[model samples]
Target: MSRVLLLGGTGDALRIARSLRAEHVYSLAGLGRTPVDLACGVRVGGFGGAQGLVRYLADEAIALLVDATHPYAARISANARAASSDARVPYWALRRPAWEPQADDDWRFVDAWPHVVAALAPFRRPLFTLGREPLAHLDAIPAHQHWTVRCLDAHPGNERARIIDARGPFTLDGERALFDAGGYDVVVSKNSGGAATEAKLQVARERRLPVVMLRRPALPAADREFGDVAGVIDALRAQPFPIVR
Candidate 1:
């Protein structure tokens, strides 16, 4: 049987991995502070860039490659595209749709993080839910304005900032409570477009708080693209089991 290499981290990845357990082997970048419960034969960490991934494909005999990483993870997605071409493996992407604002939503779509920082200057208490990696851009927020940075882990390095470490699937009531306690005037978040972290947006709508939403980067053209796991599974199953290589 031909082996499949799955680049997994997002919810879509988990669903596809579970569905195609017999043919797919999952790999995670392991950047998260917490461990994710995935199926057996899962590998963690980088593959040393494109060349490294090429070597792994040949060594493990990966015939089909699935890129199902986070939307903001452009580097790995690019590497997967390059490495698949180099290794002559077929590839596909599981890209979820981004969330659209309702009539009551007060959203500002920004192209980049710097713009998010610039737009935040007017707000005194700005709430950042853009995740830890993107927090590096928080320096652009002027000294006058106070920031409430929320993430999943407490970094010893980030002791000086007002950091709130929490996880979610947050409820609207919970998000409201958080906003109320912080007295936030605005929210800065990536347009990650999923139900998992969308409660913040709902709360922002209710309070009529302005949201600086960072748009997703454009991905490279994939041989096949799917918005859901079922579509990905259907496409994968349609391909021939054996690769010529």
Candidate 2:
């Protein structure tokens, strides 16, 4: 049976990883908690780049490469496609659908950081769900603004900003409490289409707050693309290797 290499970090990726056989490998970028309960082999950290990943695939005899990374992870996805092509392996991607704006949503889409900053100028209290990107701009925060940033890990934030370290699969009540406590006038987010962190959007909608959305990046094409974990699982089952249930 051929071995599979799954590049993953998202919750959706974890679900697919859980279904892989022991011979298959799950790779992470070493950003958050590494799961110890997985049946397949877990490889943490990067593979250098596309060339390095190609070496890894050849060294480990990886026959299938699956890109299950976050939607914002364009570079990694690109590398995965390039590496898979060079290694002569099939490349599959799980492209989760982006969130659609509801009729009540006040979503302002921005392609870059400067635009996000411009969109945020009118709001005094902004809740940033764009991860650690805001942490870098803490010192640049306007005197009138107080930034609240949420990411996977905790960090020491300056007086102008407050960093909250938390993982998602967040509930509506929890999001409501967060919004209430923060008293945020605006929300800064990526169009990461998944249920895990979607409650914030609902909370924003309820409060009638404007969300400064970072536009999704264009990703490389794959031999097969799946919209959800179940689709990927089904595809894997049809592959030559037997999936570990």
Candidate 3:
């Protein structure tokens, strides 16, 4: 069994770890957040940077490297790719495909989070399902409308950033209640591309509200790309172990 380092935090990462648990593979997760009951063995905190990551890989004698991070986590992915190359470890990513918009979805796709604010025209009050980092972007765009922002932590500071403290895998009833109670005419969500946060989109669809969708950055031109967990496991199995030269 190869000792693989799994760089992960997102749902896809969790999925991949669970899938490989029975393969007799010894897996360790590299995480920014303190893992709460992770599917595999874990290590928390940054690995310095690309150089630091490479050194850690070398010291641990990691046989494989998987960058199964969030799509928005470009810095870590970049570091993972660079470190894997430097350490001569086989590298792969478990990135999920972005959600496609249906005509009935009434989505306005935007490039950046800041730009998303500008993209919004006059509508009814919006329900913002934004990430913690980009919360300020909502205030950047002109305000002909109001917004309700959701966060796991107690969102303080910005009077403009209306805060709703809650967590993920949001229930359908909860989503519907939020929309109905907030009097939201539209939904603003990141193309996070996971089941956990998807209820917001479903709520928007039910209400026939316009959704401002933030798209993902393009993956680096790696040799492979897998839109699912199964594909990721296959990649892990196919890649040969690092040569101890």
RMSD of each: 3.3, 0.9, 4.4
Q: lDDT of all predictions, in order shown?
A: 0.80, 0.94, 0.70
lDDT for 83 (candidate 2): 96
What's model 3's lDDT at 54?
90
Over 1-245, each residue of candidate 1 has an lDDT whose tens digit, in order, gives 57889898776677676656544578888865323454436777999999999999999989889999989989999999999999998889988899899999989988876687678778888888888854674455466777888887775323335887887778888998998898999998988877889999999998999999888997877778898877887877677773111
Q: Candidate 2's residue-wise lDDT over 118-165, tens digit each?
A: 999899999999977888888899999999999999899988889999
TM-score of each: 0.88, 0.98, 0.80
Which candidate model has the greater lDDT, 1 or 2? 2
- Tens digit per residue, CA lDDT, model 3, 78-101: 888888888888787777767877
Score residue 140 of candidate 2 by CA lDDT: 94
Q: For each candidate, how many residue pairs have backbone atoms clashing (under 3 Å)?
A: 0, 0, 0
lDDT of 3: 0.70
The weakest ten consecutive residues by lDDT in model 2 span 236-245
Positional deviation of 76 in candidate 1, in angstroms?
0.9
Candidate that scores best on TM-score: 2
Error of 2 at 81 (Å): 0.5
